[model samples]
Target: MQGENVSLHCRKKDANSSYTAKFYKNGISIGSSSSGNIMAPTVSKSDEGLYKCSIADAGESPESWLSVADLGFPQVLPNRQQFFQGEPITISCEGLNGRTGWRVMKKINGDIRICASTWETLIGSCNICNAYPSTDSGEYWCEHGEIQKSNSVNITVSGHPTVPYFKFYLVLYTGLSLLLVVILLILAGLFQHHKHQQTIRSHTKEMSLTPDDDTLYSKAIYTTLRPGETELKGHKKRAD
Candidate 1:
């Protein structure tokens, strides 16, 4: 991996002999060591190249190739599947091996864009102060000089409120409306039943306070005729 320790040693026929050795990296002199060994601590991608060592009386050794790879993939901070409009976001492209110069890349609506070229960014991170759904939602990853790439992540930005909770609110509103309608229907039914009961009570009270048709006729006849007139009226009727 990238962050590893490397030690180079010069070999000789006499192992007990003390000789000064000089190290060269990519055809250039690096340093000289009296112990015939050189230690490179915490090697990175920049340290990868050809290396060799030369002795005072002996010729130069064969050149060896050193390769370095990334320790880990790039990551998005506060990882999530969704974001809101105008929300701030950060994407980190720094390698775990402490390597910088990694650029953040994104593919939105089939268009590819780089953070260093298209957006504002720092050394190995992309920061968006105000993210928009139309332009910010897509796949994001890291790239180094267009040669190496990291794992990608899918991001979705919502223009409205959180989708799941918004749906829940809609459902809640509908349920409350239905409940209110049911309550109103029950109240209307109760009012109608109460009015019918009151009408029935009023009819019963009138019947109890007033006399019947036959009783009213007898009272009217007695009030119109006298007692003697009643007897004469009966005798005249019999003679006729």
Candidate 2:
């Protein structure tokens, strides 16, 4: 609460005498007033501590403890702590109030930097466009000045895995297709050759069943003799 007007007045018993007032926090001078009134515009947590007001010429007042209530703590967004190389990541540093000393801190390579300058800032968040292994792996957190800090978020990066398995399967499927085609062609050729052999065998069997022309048309000679007489007569005859 930095804007709430809270006034601390130091009034002495004698109203006629006017004295200047000086405010102190933990024995440290913070502000001074002429009319013995310390006006705190906003009571921030930083303003929490012992408070005392002193009269200019008179002695200092008794110390009074000024305690400020706690609001929500600072935090990060996109809660996962792991990341991949060349991957886009988003981080945020949020405090109780808007931009009230809320800053994002990254510790990498033994160094630290506010994310707003190096990373893109949008809607109160930081965007690391492409995370890498070199300077993007380490702890991150939300900080409110140097006192209050959020829990650390660790990030890790790794290389992308190769995809040769896909190519290997592709080549394997192609070889198998070619082998199947060759096998089918060989089967077809063998079937055709077997059919040709059967046709040739059928023709040879038919030829063996048919008689030769010379054997089928050969002529025979016959001779006849008369009774009690010898006579020689020969004639070629075609027998049915």
- The candidate scoring highest on lDDT is 1
Q: List the candidate 1 regions with Cα displacement exceeding 4 Å.
A: 1-79, 84-130, 138-152, 158-177, 212-227, 231-240
lDDT of 2: 0.69
**Against the true structure, whose TM-score is highest?**
1
**Tens digits of lDDT, candidate 1, 90-135:** 8888763466788888899999988555544545788877788888
RMSD of each: 9.4, 13.2
> What is the Cα-based lDDT of residue 84 in candidate 2?
56
Worst 10 residues of 2 by lDDT: 231-240
Give lDDT for model 1: 0.78
TM per model?
0.40, 0.38
Per-residue lDDT of model 2, residues 43-112, tens digit only: 6667778889887667888999877654443253345555558778777665355555566778888888
- With candidate 2 superimposed using the best TM-score fit, by how many Å does residue 47's alpha carbon deviate from the native? 5.9
